[model samples]
Target: MNRILLQLAGLFSALSLSAFGGGKVVLPSMHQAAVGEYHWMTSQQFVDLFSISMAAPGPSMMVVTLVGLKACMPYGTVAAILGALVATFAMFVPSSVLVYFAGNWWDHWKESPWRHAVMDAIMPISTGLILAATWIISKTSIHTVPTAILGVIALLLMLFTKINPVLMMAAAGAISWVFLS
Candidate 1:
């Protein structure tokens, strides 16, 4: 038990340091580690937890708390929580220091061709990850043509309508419980 916890802690810690361009950018790696490598949760579970975390307060990184809780019990939660904190600190501290001291340099670099080239290199990687996460969610949530249609319609409606996302999700849940179940 302790060994697995320690391993998970180390894995998450390393992942934290590797995360770039905020949480979404490194999400695919995190998903791979947690869902594929660790078998801590299913892809659907990750999607559900992500939704729940987003709907709640605080940073979207709260998904780490959910993952930690799911991975073990109190100890797992502690380790995961600490892992998240360490990850955030590891990323933030350097950034904060850089911004504090080298703010103008960073701003100047933004206009450099190298900055554009770096953005170009990273854009596809980030997009691919986001697409993979979407595919994983779709695989679980849209098992049938009707459900797929529902999802598409829900997506379009959210994009076009003023309806609250929380309300839409609730409605979808009710409909699923009624027809799909």
Candidate 2:
């Protein structure tokens, strides 16, 4: 009820603030919170939700909406939608507002040498965060040899080819449905 919605709001809000690199960067912690600390979902469910989110997405962080919905499943669908909306707002609005203001301030300082220096310094950290997120997703996702093969194929396709990502997604799904499963 009220308690669950509040918890969702708090958890997403905290994650929103911490999403320095991107929504993906927060997956590990969000997974721990939803699957571990709150006991709201099993690890398998968390992994499944993430897979679902990536497959059907406006944004990668749509996983938050899935998490929220799953959290309130015992309630009716309306409650579940409310839970999703609340978590989505918590995850997006606060960080967006901060970025908006920060963008304004940053523009004013855009010409400063120190600004470029700061960006250069932070690039490595951002890259590292993204790499860590990749590892986290890989560990959660590559549950079997076939899935790992699919992951490697997808990675190679992305890195070296001009193949459409949607096509890759479909190929992976087809492979999984036909073989991996």
Query: TM-score of every model?
Result: 0.70, 0.90
Candidate 2, residues 108-159, lDDT tens digits: the string is 7987899878878777877887787678767877878888888988999999
For model 1, state the Cα shift of residue 148 in Å.
Answer: 1.4
The Cα error of candidate 1 at residue 7, in Å, is 3.4
For model 1, residues 88-174, the per-residue Cα lDDT tens digits are: 454345545655787768878877899888888878877876687677667766789878878998989989999977678778878
Global lDDT scores for all candidate models: 0.69, 0.86
Off by over 4 Å in 2: none
Q: Provide the clashing-pair count of each candidate structure.
A: 0, 0
- Which candidate has the top score in TM-score? 2
Clashing pairs in 1: none
Task: Please report, as a residue range, the 10-residue window in candidate 2 with the lowest summed lDDT.
Answer: 132-141
Which candidate wins on lDDT?
2
